[model samples]
Target: MKRSYGFLLTAMAFTLVTLVPVGDLPAQQATASSAALPFKWEELTAPNFIKAVELSGGTCIIPLGVIEKHGPHLPLGTDLIDVRAVVLRAAQTEYSIIFPEYYFSQIFEAKHQPGTIAYGERLIWDMLQNTCDEISRNGIKKIILVSGHGGNNSFLPFFCQAQLASRKDYAVYLFQPPNDPAFEAEVARMRKSKMEQHAGEGETSAILAVRPDLAHQEVATTQSGEDLKRLESMKGVYTGIWWYASFPNHYAGEGRYGSREIGEKELNHQAEQLVKVIREVKADKTVLELQKQFYDESAQPLKTRQ
Candidate 1:
Protein backbone atom coordinates (compact mmCIF):
# COMPACT_ATOMS: atom_id res chain seq x y z
CA MET A 1 0.00 0.00 0.00
CA LYS A 2 1.05 3.60 -0.68
CA ARG A 3 0.32 6.78 1.26
CA SER A 4 0.14 10.49 0.37
CA TYR A 5 0.70 13.53 2.56
CA GLY A 6 -2.80 14.72 1.70
CA PHE A 7 -4.25 11.83 3.65
CA LEU A 8 -2.24 12.89 6.69
CA LEU A 9 -3.32 16.52 6.36
CA THR A 10 -6.96 15.58 6.05
CA ALA A 11 -6.64 13.20 8.96
CA MET A 12 -4.99 15.83 11.11
CA ALA A 13 -7.65 18.43 10.31
CA PHE A 14 -10.42 15.89 10.79
CA THR A 15 -9.06 15.00 14.23
CA LEU A 16 -9.78 18.60 15.24
CA VAL A 17 -13.25 19.49 13.85
CA THR A 18 -15.03 16.43 15.23
CA LEU A 19 -15.20 16.50 19.05
CA VAL A 20 -17.41 14.38 21.27
CA PRO A 21 -17.37 14.68 25.07
CA VAL A 22 -17.70 11.47 27.09
CA GLY A 23 -19.59 11.50 30.36
CA ASP A 24 -18.12 10.50 33.72
CA LEU A 25 -15.59 7.87 34.79
CA PRO A 26 -15.81 5.04 37.26
CA ALA A 27 -14.69 5.99 40.78
CA GLN A 28 -12.02 3.30 41.00
CA GLN A 29 -10.61 3.96 37.56
CA ALA A 30 -10.46 7.71 38.22
CA THR A 31 -8.76 7.10 41.55
CA ALA A 32 -6.15 4.84 39.93
CA SER A 33 -5.09 7.48 37.40
CA SER A 34 -1.83 9.39 37.89
CA ALA A 35 -1.85 13.13 38.61
CA ALA A 36 0.97 13.69 36.09
CA LEU A 37 -1.45 12.50 33.40
CA PRO A 38 -2.70 16.02 32.78
CA PHE A 39 0.39 18.14 31.85
CA LYS A 40 4.10 18.97 32.10
CA TRP A 41 5.68 16.57 29.64
CA GLU A 42 8.94 16.79 31.58
CA GLU A 43 7.29 16.08 34.88
CA LEU A 44 6.10 12.66 33.80
CA THR A 45 8.62 10.13 35.13
CA ALA A 46 10.15 7.67 32.66
CA PRO A 47 7.99 4.83 33.97
CA ASN A 48 4.88 7.02 34.27
CA PHE A 49 5.44 8.37 30.73
CA ILE A 50 4.59 4.95 29.35
CA LYS A 51 1.31 5.01 31.20
CA ALA A 52 0.68 8.61 30.18
CA VAL A 53 1.29 7.73 26.54
CA GLU A 54 -1.09 4.83 26.71
CA LEU A 55 -3.68 6.88 28.58
CA SER A 56 -3.52 9.57 25.94
CA GLY A 57 -3.49 6.87 23.27
CA GLY A 58 -0.23 8.31 21.91
CA THR A 59 -1.90 11.75 21.58
CA CYS A 60 -0.42 14.91 23.01
CA ILE A 61 -1.46 18.55 22.81
CA ILE A 62 0.95 21.41 22.23
CA PRO A 63 -0.88 24.52 23.36
CA LEU A 64 0.78 27.07 21.08
CA GLY A 65 0.66 30.81 21.79
CA VAL A 66 2.82 33.93 21.59
CA ILE A 67 4.12 36.59 23.93
CA GLU A 68 3.02 40.08 22.88
CA LYS A 69 1.79 43.37 24.34
CA HIS A 70 -1.92 43.14 25.07
CA GLY A 71 -2.76 46.71 25.96
CA PRO A 72 -2.10 48.50 29.28
CA HIS A 73 -4.13 46.22 31.52
CA LEU A 74 -3.36 42.72 30.28
CA PRO A 75 -0.08 40.89 30.77
CA LEU A 76 2.27 40.47 27.83
CA GLY A 77 1.97 36.66 28.04
CA THR A 78 -1.83 36.84 27.94
CA ASP A 79 -2.21 34.36 25.11
CA LEU A 80 0.23 31.83 26.50
CA ILE A 81 -1.09 32.02 30.03
CA ASP A 82 -4.74 31.73 29.03
CA VAL A 83 -4.29 28.85 26.61
CA ARG A 84 -2.14 26.85 29.02
CA ALA A 85 -4.74 27.05 31.74
CA VAL A 86 -7.44 25.82 29.38
CA VAL A 87 -5.24 23.03 28.01
CA LEU A 88 -4.30 21.78 31.46
CA ARG A 89 -7.91 21.73 32.57
CA ALA A 90 -8.95 19.90 29.44
CA ALA A 91 -6.20 17.34 29.85
CA GLN A 92 -7.43 16.71 33.35
CA THR A 93 -10.76 15.61 31.92
CA GLU A 94 -9.68 13.60 28.86
CA TYR A 95 -6.07 12.70 29.85
CA SER A 96 -3.52 13.76 27.22
CA ILE A 97 0.18 14.48 27.48
CA ILE A 98 0.43 18.27 27.62
CA PHE A 99 3.53 19.91 26.21
CA PRO A 100 5.14 22.57 28.34
CA GLU A 101 4.96 26.33 27.72
CA TYR A 102 5.72 26.83 24.02
CA TYR A 103 5.26 30.50 23.07
CA PHE A 104 7.25 30.29 19.85
CA SER A 105 4.75 31.07 17.09
CA GLN A 106 3.99 33.69 14.39
CA ILE A 107 3.78 37.13 15.96
CA PHE A 108 5.31 39.39 13.31
CA GLU A 109 2.12 41.39 13.21
CA ALA A 110 2.84 42.63 16.74
CA LYS A 111 6.51 43.49 16.24
CA HIS A 112 5.84 47.23 16.33
CA GLN A 113 4.58 46.84 19.88
CA PRO A 114 6.78 46.46 22.97
CA GLY A 115 7.39 43.15 24.76
CA THR A 116 6.61 41.17 21.63
CA ILE A 117 8.92 38.20 21.05
CA ALA A 118 8.97 37.36 17.38
CA TYR A 119 11.31 34.59 16.36
CA GLY A 120 12.97 34.40 12.98
CA GLU A 121 10.80 32.65 10.40
CA ARG A 122 13.26 29.81 9.97
CA LEU A 123 13.51 29.29 13.72
CA ILE A 124 9.73 29.16 14.25
CA TRP A 125 9.28 26.54 11.56
CA ASP A 126 12.28 24.57 12.71
CA MET A 127 11.19 24.68 16.34
CA LEU A 128 7.82 23.15 15.45
CA GLN A 129 9.22 20.54 13.10
CA ASN A 130 11.90 19.46 15.56
CA THR A 131 9.38 19.35 18.36
CA CYS A 132 7.11 17.06 16.35
CA ASP A 133 10.03 14.93 15.24
CA GLU A 134 11.19 14.56 18.82
CA ILE A 135 7.71 13.71 20.04
CA SER A 136 7.28 11.12 17.32
CA ARG A 137 10.60 9.70 18.31
CA ASN A 138 9.27 9.43 21.83
CA GLY A 139 6.34 7.30 20.58
CA ILE A 140 3.50 9.80 20.29
CA LYS A 141 1.79 9.55 16.90
CA LYS A 142 -0.86 12.26 17.09
CA ILE A 143 -0.14 15.88 18.05
CA ILE A 144 -2.79 18.55 18.53
CA LEU A 145 -1.96 22.23 18.39
CA VAL A 146 -4.38 24.32 20.48
CA SER A 147 -3.39 27.86 19.54
CA GLY A 148 -4.59 30.90 21.49
CA HIS A 149 -3.08 33.85 19.65
CA GLY A 150 -5.21 35.49 16.95
CA GLY A 151 -2.09 36.05 14.84
CA ASN A 152 -1.39 32.31 14.69
CA ASN A 153 -4.62 31.58 12.80
CA SER A 154 -2.93 31.55 9.41
CA PHE A 155 0.40 30.17 10.58
CA LEU A 156 -1.12 27.08 12.22
CA PRO A 157 -3.22 25.83 9.31
CA PHE A 158 -0.38 26.50 6.89
CA PHE A 159 1.99 24.59 9.15
CA CYS A 160 -0.40 21.65 9.38
CA GLN A 161 -0.78 21.46 5.61
CA ALA A 162 2.94 21.77 5.08
CA GLN A 163 3.41 18.56 7.07
CA LEU A 164 2.83 16.98 3.67
CA ALA A 165 6.26 18.14 2.52
CA SER A 166 7.50 14.70 3.60
CA ARG A 167 6.20 11.48 4.95
CA LYS A 168 6.01 11.42 8.74
CA ASP A 169 5.23 8.76 11.32
CA TYR A 170 2.98 11.13 13.27
CA ALA A 171 0.06 13.46 12.54
CA VAL A 172 -0.65 17.04 13.67
CA TYR A 173 -4.11 18.28 14.72
CA LEU A 174 -5.59 21.65 15.72
CA PHE A 175 -8.87 22.31 17.48
CA GLN A 176 -11.10 25.28 16.77
CA PRO A 177 -12.77 26.75 19.80
CA PRO A 178 -16.07 24.98 20.25
CA ASN A 179 -19.40 26.33 18.97
CA ASP A 180 -22.51 24.60 20.25
CA PRO A 181 -26.07 25.90 20.34
CA ALA A 182 -26.18 25.55 24.11
CA PHE A 183 -22.67 26.94 24.48
CA GLU A 184 -23.47 29.98 22.31
CA ALA A 185 -26.58 30.54 24.40
CA GLU A 186 -24.44 30.37 27.53
CA VAL A 187 -22.04 32.98 26.15
CA ALA A 188 -24.89 35.37 25.40
CA ARG A 189 -26.27 34.88 28.86
CA MET A 190 -22.91 35.57 30.49
CA ARG A 191 -21.51 38.49 28.50
CA LYS A 192 -21.84 41.76 30.38
CA SER A 193 -20.47 43.89 27.59
CA LYS A 194 -19.22 43.80 23.99
CA MET A 195 -15.79 45.26 23.37
CA GLU A 196 -14.17 45.63 19.95
CA GLN A 197 -10.89 43.68 19.99
CA HIS A 198 -7.61 43.44 21.91
CA ALA A 199 -8.14 43.48 25.64
CA GLY A 200 -11.84 43.70 24.91
CA GLU A 201 -14.68 42.37 27.04
CA GLY A 202 -14.41 38.81 25.81
CA GLU A 203 -10.62 38.60 26.11
CA THR A 204 -10.53 40.49 29.38
CA SER A 205 -13.19 38.29 30.87
CA ALA A 206 -11.19 35.25 29.78
CA ILE A 207 -8.06 36.49 31.50
CA LEU A 208 -10.03 37.44 34.57
CA ALA A 209 -11.16 33.86 35.00
CA VAL A 210 -7.74 32.28 34.51
CA ARG A 211 -5.55 34.95 36.14
CA PRO A 212 -7.48 37.69 37.96
CA ASP A 213 -4.45 39.15 39.69
CA LEU A 214 -2.91 40.23 36.39
CA ALA A 215 -6.16 41.66 35.05
CA HIS A 216 -6.51 45.40 35.61
CA GLN A 217 -10.08 46.03 34.57
CA GLU A 218 -9.91 49.41 36.33
CA VAL A 219 -7.29 50.67 33.85
CA ALA A 220 -9.09 49.25 30.85
CA THR A 221 -10.39 52.74 30.06
CA THR A 222 -6.95 54.34 30.32
CA GLN A 223 -6.46 53.81 26.58
CA SER A 224 -9.10 54.44 23.94
CA GLY A 225 -8.53 50.96 22.45
CA GLU A 226 -11.23 51.99 19.99
CA ASP A 227 -11.23 52.17 16.20
CA LEU A 228 -9.33 55.28 15.16
CA LYS A 229 -10.92 55.34 11.66
CA ARG A 230 -7.44 55.55 10.21
CA LEU A 231 -8.51 53.55 7.16
CA GLU A 232 -12.24 53.00 7.13
CA SER A 233 -12.22 52.67 3.36
CA MET A 234 -10.02 49.58 3.58
CA LYS A 235 -12.91 47.55 4.97
CA GLY A 236 -14.04 46.38 1.51
CA VAL A 237 -10.63 44.81 0.94
CA TYR A 238 -8.58 42.85 3.43
CA THR A 239 -4.97 43.92 3.84
CA GLY A 240 -2.27 43.38 6.46
CA ILE A 241 -2.47 47.06 7.31
CA TRP A 242 -6.17 46.93 8.11
CA TRP A 243 -5.58 45.89 11.70
CA TYR A 244 -2.91 48.49 12.31
CA ALA A 245 -4.98 51.21 10.61
CA SER A 246 -8.06 50.54 12.69
CA PHE A 247 -6.42 49.84 16.04
CA PRO A 248 -3.26 51.88 16.24
CA ASN A 249 -2.76 51.19 19.93
CA HIS A 250 -2.83 47.48 19.10
CA TYR A 251 -5.72 47.47 21.48
CA ALA A 252 -9.43 47.52 20.67
CA GLY A 253 -12.70 46.66 22.41
CA GLU A 254 -13.89 47.50 25.92
CA GLY A 255 -12.27 45.79 28.88
CA ARG A 256 -14.59 47.16 31.50
CA TYR A 257 -17.35 45.00 30.05
CA GLY A 258 -15.40 41.81 30.78
CA SER A 259 -16.24 39.72 33.81
CA ARG A 260 -14.73 36.61 35.34
CA GLU A 261 -17.96 34.73 34.80
CA ILE A 262 -17.76 35.16 31.05
CA GLY A 263 -14.12 34.11 30.99
CA GLU A 264 -14.87 30.97 32.97
CA LYS A 265 -17.67 30.07 30.61
CA GLU A 266 -15.51 30.42 27.50
CA LEU A 267 -12.51 28.64 28.98
CA ASN A 268 -14.55 25.81 30.48
CA HIS A 269 -16.50 25.31 27.29
CA GLN A 270 -13.30 25.10 25.29
CA ALA A 271 -11.83 22.66 27.79
CA GLU A 272 -14.92 20.47 27.58
CA GLN A 273 -14.63 20.34 23.81
CA LEU A 274 -10.94 19.52 24.06
CA VAL A 275 -11.75 16.58 26.31
CA LYS A 276 -13.91 15.12 23.58
CA VAL A 277 -11.16 15.45 20.99
CA ILE A 278 -8.59 13.75 23.19
CA ARG A 279 -10.85 10.77 23.66
CA GLU A 280 -11.60 10.44 19.96
CA VAL A 281 -7.97 10.64 18.91
CA LYS A 282 -7.13 7.93 21.41
CA ALA A 283 -9.38 5.46 19.59
CA ASP A 284 -8.88 6.70 16.03
CA LYS A 285 -7.71 3.96 13.62
CA THR A 286 -9.14 5.11 10.32
CA VAL A 287 -6.64 7.97 9.81
CA LEU A 288 -3.59 5.80 10.35
CA GLU A 289 -4.96 3.02 8.17
CA LEU A 290 -5.86 5.39 5.33
CA GLN A 291 -2.50 7.16 5.55
CA LYS A 292 -0.64 3.87 5.18
CA GLN A 293 -2.72 2.87 2.16
CA PHE A 294 -2.20 6.24 0.47
CA TYR A 295 1.55 6.18 1.10
CA ASP A 296 1.83 2.67 -0.37
CA GLU A 297 -0.18 3.68 -3.42
CA SER A 298 1.89 6.83 -4.09
CA ALA A 299 5.12 4.82 -4.38
CA GLN A 300 3.77 2.91 -7.40
CA PRO A 301 2.12 5.64 -9.44
CA LEU A 302 3.17 3.88 -12.70
CA LYS A 303 1.22 0.80 -11.68
CA THR A 304 -1.86 2.90 -10.87
CA ARG A 305 -3.36 2.62 -14.39
CA GLN A 306 -6.48 4.73 -14.99
Candidate 2:
Protein backbone atom coordinates (compact mmCIF):
# COMPACT_ATOMS: atom_id res chain seq x y z
CA MET A 1 0.00 0.00 0.00
CA LYS A 2 1.10 3.56 -0.74
CA ARG A 3 1.45 6.12 2.06
CA SER A 4 1.53 9.88 1.88
CA TYR A 5 4.10 12.01 3.69
CA GLY A 6 2.21 15.27 3.14
CA PHE A 7 1.30 15.67 6.79
CA LEU A 8 4.77 14.76 7.98
CA LEU A 9 6.42 17.14 5.54
CA THR A 10 4.14 19.95 6.67
CA ALA A 11 4.89 19.28 10.34
CA MET A 12 8.60 19.18 9.63
CA ALA A 13 8.34 22.48 7.80
CA PHE A 14 6.85 24.10 10.88
CA THR A 15 9.61 22.74 13.11
CA LEU A 16 12.25 24.13 10.75
CA VAL A 17 10.98 27.71 10.46
CA THR A 18 13.30 30.32 11.95
CA LEU A 19 13.58 34.10 11.89
CA VAL A 20 16.09 35.03 9.22
CA PRO A 21 16.33 37.48 6.35
CA VAL A 22 15.37 36.20 2.87
CA GLY A 23 16.73 38.56 0.25
CA ASP A 24 19.47 38.64 -2.35
CA LEU A 25 23.11 38.53 -1.32
CA PRO A 26 24.83 41.83 -1.80
CA ALA A 27 28.21 42.30 -3.42
CA GLN A 28 29.60 42.51 0.10
CA GLN A 29 28.84 40.27 3.08
CA ALA A 30 28.53 43.37 5.25
CA THR A 31 25.31 44.34 3.43
CA ALA A 32 23.90 40.80 3.55
CA SER A 33 23.14 41.01 7.26
CA SER A 34 20.45 43.63 6.74
CA ALA A 35 18.90 41.90 3.72
CA ALA A 36 19.41 38.25 4.61
CA LEU A 37 16.32 36.01 4.87
CA PRO A 38 15.40 32.62 6.30
CA PHE A 39 16.32 29.79 3.93
CA LYS A 40 13.75 27.29 5.15
CA TRP A 41 10.36 26.91 3.45
CA GLU A 42 8.37 26.66 6.65
CA GLU A 43 10.29 29.51 8.26
CA LEU A 44 9.50 32.07 5.59
CA THR A 45 6.49 34.35 5.93
CA ALA A 46 4.15 34.59 2.95
CA PRO A 47 5.80 37.87 2.02
CA ASN A 48 9.30 36.66 2.78
CA PHE A 49 8.78 33.58 0.63
CA ILE A 50 8.64 35.85 -2.41
CA LYS A 51 11.91 37.45 -1.39
CA ALA A 52 13.39 34.01 -0.82
CA VAL A 53 12.38 32.97 -4.32
CA GLU A 54 14.28 35.93 -5.66
CA LEU A 55 17.21 35.57 -3.28
CA SER A 56 17.51 31.86 -3.94
CA GLY A 57 16.94 32.46 -7.67
CA GLY A 58 14.08 29.98 -7.35
CA THR A 59 16.33 27.28 -5.90
CA CYS A 60 15.26 24.78 -3.22
CA ILE A 61 16.77 21.64 -1.76
CA ILE A 62 15.15 18.38 -0.61
CA PRO A 63 17.46 16.37 1.63
CA LEU A 64 16.38 12.75 1.15
CA GLY A 65 16.73 10.36 4.06
CA VAL A 66 15.57 6.83 4.98
CA ILE A 67 14.44 5.14 8.20
CA GLU A 68 16.34 1.90 8.61
CA LYS A 69 18.36 0.05 11.20
CA HIS A 70 21.99 1.06 11.16
CA GLY A 71 23.24 -1.43 13.71
CA PRO A 72 22.54 -2.45 17.27
CA HIS A 73 24.54 0.53 18.50
CA LEU A 74 23.52 3.35 16.18
CA PRO A 75 20.08 4.94 15.78
CA LEU A 76 17.71 3.72 13.08
CA GLY A 77 17.54 7.19 11.49
CA THR A 78 21.31 7.60 11.27
CA ASP A 79 21.41 8.37 7.56
CA LEU A 80 18.53 10.84 7.76
CA ILE A 81 20.09 12.71 10.67
CA ASP A 82 23.56 12.93 9.15
CA VAL A 83 22.43 13.97 5.68
CA ARG A 84 20.03 16.62 7.00
CA ALA A 85 22.79 18.05 9.19
CA VAL A 86 25.05 18.56 6.20
CA VAL A 87 22.35 20.12 4.00
CA LEU A 88 21.10 22.39 6.75
CA ARG A 89 24.61 23.63 7.40
CA ALA A 90 25.17 24.26 3.72
CA ALA A 91 21.86 26.16 3.40
CA GLN A 92 22.89 28.51 6.19
CA THR A 93 25.89 29.63 4.15
CA GLU A 94 24.46 29.53 0.61
CA TYR A 95 20.83 30.60 1.22
CA SER A 96 18.54 28.01 -0.44
CA ILE A 97 15.07 27.10 0.85
CA ILE A 98 15.59 23.79 2.68
CA PHE A 99 12.76 21.29 2.53
CA PRO A 100 11.84 19.24 5.57
CA GLU A 101 13.00 15.66 6.31
CA TYR A 102 12.19 13.27 3.44
CA TYR A 103 12.88 9.54 4.05
CA PHE A 104 11.04 7.93 1.14
CA SER A 105 13.51 5.85 -0.83
CA GLN A 106 14.73 2.27 -1.54
CA ILE A 107 15.33 0.20 1.58
CA PHE A 108 13.69 -3.13 0.86
CA GLU A 109 16.92 -4.95 1.73
CA ALA A 110 16.48 -3.91 5.34
CA LYS A 111 12.76 -4.83 5.63
CA HIS A 112 13.62 -7.75 7.88
CA GLN A 113 15.23 -5.39 10.34
CA PRO A 114 13.17 -3.49 12.88
CA GLY A 115 12.29 0.20 12.25
CA THR A 116 12.82 -0.06 8.51
CA ILE A 117 10.14 1.76 6.43
CA ALA A 118 10.16 0.37 2.93
CA TYR A 119 7.37 1.80 0.77
CA GLY A 120 6.20 0.23 -2.46
CA GLU A 121 8.55 0.99 -5.38
CA ARG A 122 5.86 2.75 -7.45
CA LEU A 123 4.86 4.89 -4.50
CA ILE A 124 8.45 6.08 -4.11
CA TRP A 125 8.49 7.17 -7.77
CA ASP A 126 5.16 9.02 -7.75
CA MET A 127 5.80 10.71 -4.43
CA LEU A 128 9.11 12.12 -5.59
CA GLN A 129 7.60 13.24 -8.88
CA ASN A 130 4.69 14.93 -7.19
CA THR A 131 7.00 16.52 -4.64
CA CYS A 132 9.00 18.14 -7.40
CA ASP A 133 5.87 19.17 -9.26
CA GLU A 134 4.47 20.75 -6.13
CA ILE A 135 7.68 22.57 -5.49
CA SER A 136 7.55 24.00 -8.98
CA ARG A 137 3.93 25.02 -8.48
CA ASN A 138 5.07 26.85 -5.34
CA GLY A 139 7.44 28.89 -7.59
CA ILE A 140 10.79 27.15 -7.03
CA LYS A 141 12.04 25.82 -10.36
CA LYS A 142 15.33 24.15 -9.52
CA ILE A 143 14.97 21.23 -7.12
CA ILE A 144 18.14 19.81 -5.64
CA LEU A 145 17.95 16.34 -4.12
CA VAL A 146 20.62 15.43 -1.57
CA SER A 147 20.25 11.81 -0.54
CA GLY A 148 21.53 10.43 2.76
CA HIS A 149 21.07 6.74 2.06
CA GLY A 150 23.34 4.82 -0.30
CA GLY A 151 20.46 2.53 -1.32
CA ASN A 152 18.93 5.49 -3.14
CA ASN A 153 21.94 5.80 -5.45
CA SER A 154 20.30 3.62 -8.09
CA PHE A 155 16.69 4.84 -7.74
CA LEU A 156 17.40 8.57 -7.83
CA PRO A 157 19.17 8.52 -11.19
CA PHE A 158 16.40 6.50 -12.77
CA PHE A 159 13.84 8.96 -11.38
CA CYS A 160 15.72 11.87 -12.93
CA GLN A 161 15.84 10.13 -16.31
CA ALA A 162 12.11 9.43 -16.11
CA GLN A 163 11.54 13.18 -16.10
CA LEU A 164 11.92 12.99 -19.89
CA ALA A 165 8.81 10.87 -20.04
CA SER A 166 6.79 14.07 -19.96
CA ARG A 167 7.52 17.78 -20.15
CA LYS A 168 8.13 19.51 -16.84
CA ASP A 169 8.94 23.07 -15.83
CA TYR A 170 11.66 22.42 -13.28
CA ALA A 171 15.05 20.68 -13.32
CA VAL A 172 16.02 18.08 -10.74
CA TYR A 173 19.66 18.03 -9.75
CA LEU A 174 21.04 15.17 -7.67
CA PHE A 175 23.83 15.96 -5.29
CA GLN A 176 26.56 13.41 -5.98
CA PRO A 177 29.67 15.28 -4.91
CA PRO A 178 33.05 13.81 -5.73
CA ASN A 179 35.43 13.13 -2.85
CA ASP A 180 38.51 15.26 -2.66
CA PRO A 181 41.70 13.21 -3.06
CA ALA A 182 43.55 15.19 -0.39
CA PHE A 183 40.66 14.86 2.01
CA GLU A 184 40.43 11.12 1.36
CA ALA A 185 44.15 10.83 2.19
CA GLU A 186 43.64 12.79 5.40
CA VAL A 187 40.70 10.55 6.40
CA ALA A 188 42.79 7.46 5.66
CA ARG A 189 45.37 8.74 8.12
CA MET A 190 42.74 9.45 10.80
CA ARG A 191 40.57 6.36 10.31
CA LYS A 192 41.15 3.48 12.76
CA SER A 193 39.15 0.91 10.79
CA LYS A 194 39.23 0.18 7.04
CA MET A 195 35.57 -0.91 6.69
CA GLU A 196 33.23 2.03 7.26
CA GLN A 197 30.41 1.65 4.76
CA HIS A 198 27.30 1.04 6.92
CA ALA A 199 27.05 1.75 10.64
CA GLY A 200 30.80 1.25 10.71
CA GLU A 201 33.65 3.42 11.99
CA GLY A 202 33.26 6.31 9.56
CA GLU A 203 29.44 6.40 9.66
CA THR A 204 29.38 6.03 13.44
CA SER A 205 31.98 8.76 13.77
CA ALA A 206 29.87 11.07 11.59
CA ILE A 207 26.82 10.43 13.81
CA LEU A 208 28.88 11.18 16.88
CA ALA A 209 29.79 14.54 15.43
CA VAL A 210 26.16 15.32 14.62
CA ARG A 211 24.51 13.76 17.71
CA PRO A 212 26.94 12.38 20.25
CA ASP A 213 24.28 11.24 22.74
CA LEU A 214 22.67 8.96 20.17
CA ALA A 215 25.93 7.34 19.13
CA HIS A 216 26.70 4.45 21.43
CA GLN A 217 30.36 3.67 20.83
CA GLU A 218 30.52 1.13 23.71
CA VAL A 219 27.90 -1.20 22.19
CA ALA A 220 29.44 -0.96 18.72
CA THR A 221 31.29 -4.22 19.23
CA THR A 222 28.17 -6.17 20.18
CA GLN A 223 27.71 -7.51 16.64
CA SER A 224 30.16 -8.61 13.97
CA GLY A 225 29.82 -6.83 10.59
CA GLU A 226 32.10 -9.22 8.71
CA ASP A 227 30.98 -10.42 5.25
CA LEU A 228 29.84 -14.05 5.30
CA LYS A 229 31.19 -14.74 1.75
CA ARG A 230 28.16 -16.89 0.93
CA LEU A 231 28.19 -15.83 -2.72
CA GLU A 232 31.92 -15.97 -3.40
CA SER A 233 31.54 -18.44 -6.25
CA MET A 234 28.90 -16.28 -7.95
CA LYS A 235 30.98 -13.09 -7.86
CA GLY A 236 30.04 -12.06 -11.38
CA VAL A 237 26.32 -12.34 -10.72
CA TYR A 238 24.16 -9.47 -9.47
CA THR A 239 21.18 -10.27 -7.29
CA GLY A 240 18.83 -8.38 -4.97
CA ILE A 241 19.77 -10.67 -2.10
CA TRP A 242 23.49 -9.89 -2.34
CA TRP A 243 23.29 -7.44 0.58
CA TYR A 244 21.41 -9.84 2.87
CA ALA A 245 23.52 -12.79 1.74
CA SER A 246 26.74 -11.13 2.86
CA PHE A 247 25.66 -9.34 6.02
CA PRO A 248 22.36 -10.69 7.26
CA ASN A 249 22.80 -8.49 10.32
CA HIS A 250 22.65 -5.45 7.96
CA TYR A 251 25.95 -4.08 9.28
CA ALA A 252 28.94 -3.55 7.00
CA GLY A 253 31.94 -2.55 9.11
CA GLU A 254 33.47 -2.10 12.57
CA GLY A 255 32.09 0.78 14.63
CA ARG A 256 34.00 0.23 17.85
CA TYR A 257 36.73 2.62 16.70
CA GLY A 258 34.43 5.56 15.84
CA SER A 259 35.89 8.89 16.98
CA ARG A 260 34.58 12.44 17.17
CA GLU A 261 37.64 13.84 15.39
CA ILE A 262 37.02 11.67 12.34
CA GLY A 263 33.34 12.49 12.56
CA GLU A 264 34.05 16.21 12.52
CA LYS A 265 36.25 15.81 9.46
CA GLU A 266 33.72 13.75 7.53
CA LEU A 267 30.74 15.93 8.42
CA ASN A 268 32.57 19.15 7.58
CA HIS A 269 33.69 17.66 4.25
CA GLN A 270 30.12 16.82 3.24
CA ALA A 271 28.82 20.23 4.33
CA GLU A 272 31.50 21.98 2.31
CA GLN A 273 30.67 19.91 -0.75
CA LEU A 274 26.98 20.72 -0.37
CA VAL A 275 27.73 24.40 0.09
CA LYS A 276 29.42 24.36 -3.30
CA VAL A 277 26.44 22.60 -4.83
CA ILE A 278 23.95 25.18 -3.54
CA ARG A 279 26.00 28.09 -4.84
CA GLU A 280 26.37 26.46 -8.25
CA VAL A 281 22.71 25.55 -8.49
CA LYS A 282 21.67 29.06 -7.54
CA ALA A 283 23.74 30.48 -10.39
CA ASP A 284 22.57 27.92 -12.95
CA LYS A 285 20.15 28.93 -15.75
CA THR A 286 21.43 26.74 -18.57
CA VAL A 287 19.88 23.53 -17.29
CA LEU A 288 16.29 24.79 -17.37
CA GLU A 289 16.78 26.37 -20.78
CA LEU A 290 18.29 23.19 -22.18
CA GLN A 291 15.47 21.16 -20.70
CA LYS A 292 12.91 23.36 -22.41
CA GLN A 293 14.70 23.00 -25.71
CA PHE A 294 14.85 19.23 -25.41
CA TYR A 295 11.20 18.98 -24.50
CA ASP A 296 10.19 21.08 -27.49
CA GLU A 297 12.18 18.86 -29.86
CA SER A 298 10.97 15.71 -28.15
CA ALA A 299 7.35 16.72 -28.80
CA GLN A 300 8.04 16.86 -32.52
CA PRO A 301 10.81 14.32 -33.10
CA LEU A 302 9.61 13.74 -36.66
CA LYS A 303 10.55 17.32 -37.48
CA THR A 304 13.91 17.14 -35.72
CA ARG A 305 16.93 17.59 -37.94
CA GLN A 306 18.98 14.53 -38.75
The number of clashing residue pairs in each candidate reads: 13, 7
Task: Please give the TM-score that candidate 1 achieves against the real structure.
Answer: 0.84
lDDT measured at residue 114 in model 1 versus the true structure, 0 to 100: 87
Per-candidate Cα lDDT values, in order, are 0.76, 0.81
Best by TM-score: 2
Q: RMSD for each model, in Å, please?
A: 10.2, 6.0
TM-score of each: 0.84, 0.89
Model 1 global lDDT (CA atoms, 0 to 1): 0.76
Query: Tens digit of lDDT per residue, candidate 2, span 132-154?
Result: 99999989999999998999989
Which has the greatest lDDT? Answer: 2
lDDT of 1 by residue, 68-153 (tens): 87877898998887888788778756767888889999877788998989998889999999999999999999999998888888
